[model samples]
Target chain A: MNQEEIIAVQQYENALSRVDQSVDKITVLMSSAQSLAQQGTQIMNCFAQLKREQQAYEAQFKELKLKLQSDLIKFQNIVKGAEARLDRHLDYIDKWTNLLLTRDLGTMDSQELQYQRNIMDAIQMANDNFNKELDKLYSL
Target chain B: MGKNKQVQKSSLTDEDLYTMLSDNLVELNEIELFFNGFLQEANVIDESFGTVTNIFNGLSMGVLASMNKSDNEKINRAKAKIALGTFVVGQVAKGVGSFYSYVKTLDRANDILVLKKEKAATWLDSLHRNYDRVLRSEISSRKILTHLASLGYQIDELISNREVYDVKKNLMQMALEQYRKARFNVFSMEFFIAECKAWLKNKHDSNMQQPILQDVNNSIIQEVLFQGDDYEEVIAEFFLGSNEISGSILFVLNDEQLLSHYLSTRKDPLIISDGVENKHINKRVLAIFKDNPALEMSNEFYEIRKEIDEDGEKSRKIFWRLIVTGSLLSTLVSFFNLYLFCRLVMAIDDNTAILSVLAIAALLAFGGLYAKFEEIYKELKNKISKNRENYERYYRYEFALKGGFANRRKKVEEVVGKSFFDRVGKAISSLFDVGDSDDHSFYYEKLIEREYWNPFFVTVSIMLILAIILTKLNLFFVGSLVVLLFAYLKMRMRKKYFYILTFIVVLCVVFLFLYMKGVI
Candidate 1:
């Protein structure tokens, strides 16, 4: 082939090579974009799942709080029951002291005196039980 | 004469050919001009790539969902890309950093050659970008070789286009040869351009990012369960995109040998990030920063500072442990001496004077405890002074980073777009002027508060003992000690105002006199 024909062929080859390179770069870029988009969508789903888990945790916390509140109320009821028992013991003491001071043997017969003594013993036992409960409350 | 007189005849084809040649030459010139601009922009891109990588690495892992089947790949890719970008940009930024670092130390860079040297560095970097772009491209090797071949021999010989390109070896040789020629201190514009082109061509071939096919096809997927690394804030923002991700970063171990980072989605997080083992924070930051010496040094400074801090803590603990031991010993000795004094009193011997000596020893022990607190305060003040002293060093590195050294240099130029530190200095000066409440004393106040509890209790215990001794000494001594103890209490009322002045005046006079005279 003549030199002119060779030169013509070489120029054509150079242009063809550049086109190939550009097309290759563009193709890679396009595919990368598509893959990236797909990945982004997947990430969104993961975030959605986390949001659900967070909501579940909040619900669990609320339930836990209620359980603790009920336990606290049970302690309060024990204290209230102890207070009522103490009030009855005080009432008996006040009434019996007045009877003893008045020297009313007729009003307080043997059976009545026995009944007052029994009530005093019961009050003493209740006071000891309340003290034990108080110890437990303080420890808690 | 008859041949010369004959006019040279031209075909229409010859005219067309001439026009095309003229057009091609003009196009070539335009291409060169366009290339210069693109190369500069690529430098900016290279810098951006680095900074973006740091941002991604620093991306909080809170953003990335817990590693599940989905969203893991996306996060992983982002992480890997950032790491890789930092590595490459680190390489580019170092050239600029070194030049600036050199500039600072060149107290006598007044010569024309020195300024010219900077110009040469600029030119080299400008061309380096072109080389990097070429390295990362997919242009045919033949095209490059063909252009290079034209630079060497006759046009006809190079244009023949029958040659197979031996690009790898040829590039290395060409670059080395240009460098050798450049050793003559030839700073000519043409020579500089040639050298840059040679460096670029040597570094990257016409074809870029080839698949890097290996003979051993070992592309097997192994599930890496990265536990204990946990989800970090930096990676929280990273999430999986599909089940597959791919990228790379550079990692180094033992302060040398930059490694090619390989990322894959099949593995767990830090499945790959665990490149550096047992990194101090500074070293870890440095690892991210790579060849940026300013950043490396900056990180290194912090590491050293932390080590110093740990050492200081260990020392303080040892000091306190000794004090507690001493306090207990003094208490025991005081009891033993008091027992001996009681026995001597019953016997009515002159040996009872030993109690006075024991009393003096107890007072000295109290003085020792007081000194320990003072030492702690003094050390704290020293810390303030030293850190303040270090302000210059930190600022220099800051300035170096903020100046025109590394990634920050380009960022400041882009974001702030002017002399950045000028405004920073102004703000700092204004802060100092406005904050006249003396923040320095705030730290001292905290020290006093911490020291107050121990020293106060010790003083009270000592004064009570002193009062007992005084009572035994016919009441006069007891009254004197009572007076002294009350005055000490009154002094503590204005403790913050008196920390420095009171310590210097009262402590020196009181502690030294008491210590030297054996009444402390």
Candidate 2:
């Protein structure tokens, strides 16, 4: 071969070497970008998870609030009913006590006395029942 | 040396022999390229302008070449002018041709856009659609439901009607929808009424020994004008907003005459003349006209009266309406221009030309829209300025009040917060308070729990339930109970059909809910 042929061959080899080095650098950069992209994707996924968790927490909080409201409503109804019943009983007791105390008892007999005792016992029993009912209500 | 001299002498022979072959080859290649370029340009020009430039160019050059000879004494100058005229005419033809071609390409691009529309829709809508889907995935809490309901409430007050924030846009849309239905029940009307009521109530309940009109200048004048309204003070504010007018009847008469002149010219009364009592006409007109003094002047007042009289033959409403109409027309023009722009961009196969044209068109369109809204923009801006001055006056008046009014306002807020428990307590104490929507619902719910059920009522209900259960075991008893219930219901509703309707409604609602829950 002549000198021109040898010089052309050398030039071609140098160009190939430069291209080979560039290819290696490009490969490294691509791999680094791929890793960064993977990390970015993971971060985005974590954010999505956090958003979902926040939604779940809000849902739970809402459910608890509703449950509490329902319970409160029910308890209030019971208390209201109990209060009405108590007021009725107390009003009757007040009238009965006033009547018994105010009544004239000069002509009392044994049968009447027995009847009075029975009435008193019955009244006491009613009072006890009312007290028991009120105690039971307060616990609830 | 003899051979060199002979070769030098014979060089022309060598060059001549070789030159003929190379020159022909190079010239043929160059000529082929040049002709191809010219042919392409001609084809584009012919396609775009439909032979306008191509045919017209030859005619124009011929005309110019003929016109140049012996036109004027400045023969050279005439020749130069002809050259310039020809160049300009040629360039214009080419430009028109290119634009036509560009517009055609833009139309083609529009067709492509139409084809790609669904795909673009998917990209733009997907995120918003996703957000909606996620938000709607669950059955919302009652509070959330209430919040959603309240979200559509009509805005009572806003500084600007059309100028909107992101949230305000949504609010205004809701408000406008409701206002369309409610009409007179608009937020502004409600706010005005409420403010008036509050002001009047404040006046009546005022702790101060002196009457409200005692301190203010011309208090009797205001009292005589705006009598018996709970919102007398609020009405007074409208009078006060005219920047402390001279209390003279002459000044008032002059002002009225000025306003009357404007109204006469406009051919419309500024005052609310309709439904006003006939007892006092002029006084009421004076009262209301003081609020809006714009009828006191016009753009015509700034210029020469003679010019204005000629121009003022037209209605003022028509003038503004014309501007609004012009804006609408400009919108149509912009839409057409957008269409043309698309066509233009499409015709340019080059990206650079397309981008440059797009930028230019967009800038023009935005600038044009700004110009269109200039009047309305100025009006709103002026309102803000006037409102600021009025607001300062209101603040000063409020601050100068009998000390406890602002404190009472704070107390009112506290009362609102504390009254709920008190109301519930009152419901328990008072039987009439039962079935009241707010207080009754609370007590009624509270009294019916299984654990603390009112023993007396509970026993009665339990006995009733047992009796019903025992009776229901027998078909005869069940039929009798149903008959009794039917009789009771009939006494009130007067029809057995009401029972069937109620049953059907309940069943339908239950079924609907179940179906919605996917419970079959």
Candidate 3:
């Protein structure tokens, strides 16, 4: 071909190539959009599963807290019952000692009453410790 | 000049070729400008691809499911394209529809641009909406042809109608896979937050009745699990109520406080607790503590502490064993010693083998009885009070020697330059003053007093007794006399030269005696 014809053919080819590349760019963008949407969906699902795991842990924590509170209450009640029985026995002893004063009667000593009081104190201390520990766990 | 120009023009085409060339060049320039704009757009998308892909993968399980869906779509599309290409190639080879196939290629190339125009616009709008700042700003200077003009002559040669059509088809097939891989980015914080929000929405939808509870749960879960720096809270919360919690907190909370708390407050003994949990905690604590030299020394400190504890327990047990059995056994052995000596004297006239057997049997019996008694005592002690601190004296002495835990910890911190063995050696050297000249002189003096004079006197007394006993029997033990003399010489001598001199004299005397008896 002549120089002018060659130049004209070259210009047309350049134009066509530019158009082809433009189409390729558009195609890339199209595919990119589809993938982005898919990725968004996938990421959302993974996050949901992780959230579910966290929820289960929270539920478990609540259940454990309730159980600890119940245990503390049960222990406190046991301590209170023992303390009441000791008080009732002390009352009975005080009432009967006066009736038997004329005869040689076996009597509960004041030391025995002190020992019983100490035992009650020890029980109360244990209950207090349990409550303190329960408080710390509840705060957690 | 006009006639010559007319002749030159007559040789060219009747078409306005120069004008047409100029117009086509202008079109080319515009197209180049548009192409560069698209490239810049692609570059921005490529950069965002990583961030988007990471956010998607991290936040969504749906990416994998979507990957499967897209992969199937790609496979089916590729198969259809391959079938169509095969049919076109077959028709062209048979010369049945060459023009038709050529037209079809051009149509297919055009379809990629025309068909996806609306889709591309929508996607571009979406890009702008989602990532406006991420998309690079357009270059204002209109330099159109520079980028594509530099793609080399072969690229220019290949940009013909047929080749362009072929290239477009290949580009489409390749672009899908690239896009799929570069689509999601779990690392993008914005996208990650959006994904978490989406998850919250989905979870709330499922439990619509308990939406408030779901929100609370999600918040608590996020706070507990995603503790960026304050990991101690996570561990503390994990072990709050359940003693039987699985896994370990060591990875999250590597603090010494956590380790010490775990160690001290363990419900079961270390021996009975789960081995895996213990191992994990142990490895993590050691690893963390190792970063500080002072803390690393605790490994040896704890070891020595444990040894000291075991020693105290052992000494106490032995003390009890001695009180219970050793005193009675010592008395029995003393009587037995006297009886055995008598038997030895008497058995000289009888079978010496029987004497040897009797001695071995007596020794074995004592050893066996002591061992059995110790075992019984240990079992009884264990049954009575397993956690008992019955031996005060032993513990007091041990603590006095080892110092308190605080003292040991201080010592570990202080002695950071030396190893455990080196520290122990230094301690022993200090006690003995082994490096001091005065200490050596004192040791030498003590050695001479105890080893030389004391043993010499004892040996002389034994020799006298033997001499008396052998004279009564009318039998002299020449070898025994020689051996006793040699022992006395060795004990008396302090210098090496004196020892050598005594050894020579002893050897000569022994040789002379042996020659006289014909026993050499």
Q: Candidate 1, residues A1-140: lDDT per residue as tens digits?
A: 89999999999999997787566545534544454455455445544543554465346434544543453455455645544543453354344334433432222144543343333333333323322332333121
lDDT of each: 0.34, 0.35, 0.33
Q: State which candidate has the highest lDDT.
A: 2
Output the chain A TM-score of model 2: 0.40
Q: Taking the tens digit of each residue's C-alpha lDDT, what string does model 3 give over B1-520?
A: 3422342333222123222222221112222233333334323332233343444333233322334444345443443443344344333322322222222223322322332232223223322332321111001000111111111222222223333323322222121111111111111212323322323332101111111111221222233223243434544444333232211232112323223323322232121123323453443222322333223333443444344455546545554645445424432453355355546664433334434433433443444334444554566456333322222222222222221111110111121113446545544443332331323221112111111112334345534643453344211222233344445445556679667866666675566546545585
Pick the winner on DockQ between candidates 1 and 3.
Answer: 3
- Candidate 2 chain B: worst-modelled 10 consecutive residues by lDDT: B402-411
Candidate 3: where are CA atoms >4 Å away?
Answer: A1-140, B1-261, B264-305, B309-520
> What is candidate 1's lDDT per residue for B36-99, written digit by digit as tens?
3333433443334334333333332312322242244544455444445434544444343333
lDDT of 3: 0.33
Off by over 4 Å in 2: A1-25, A28-52, A55-59, A62-72, A75-140, B1-281, B284-520
TM-score of each: 0.21, 0.16, 0.17
**What tens digits encode model 2's per-residue C-alpha lDDT throughout B301-413?**
22222232333333233334444554444434444454455466544344444444434333334334334344444563454444433433332232223111111111121
Model with the higher TM-score, candidate 1 or 2: 1
What DockQ does each candidate score versus the true complex, computed on alpha carbons? 0.00, 0.00, 0.01
Q: What's the CA error at residue B510 for candidate 3, in Å? A: 48
What level of docking quality does candidate 3 show? incorrect
Better of 1 and 2 by lDDT: 2
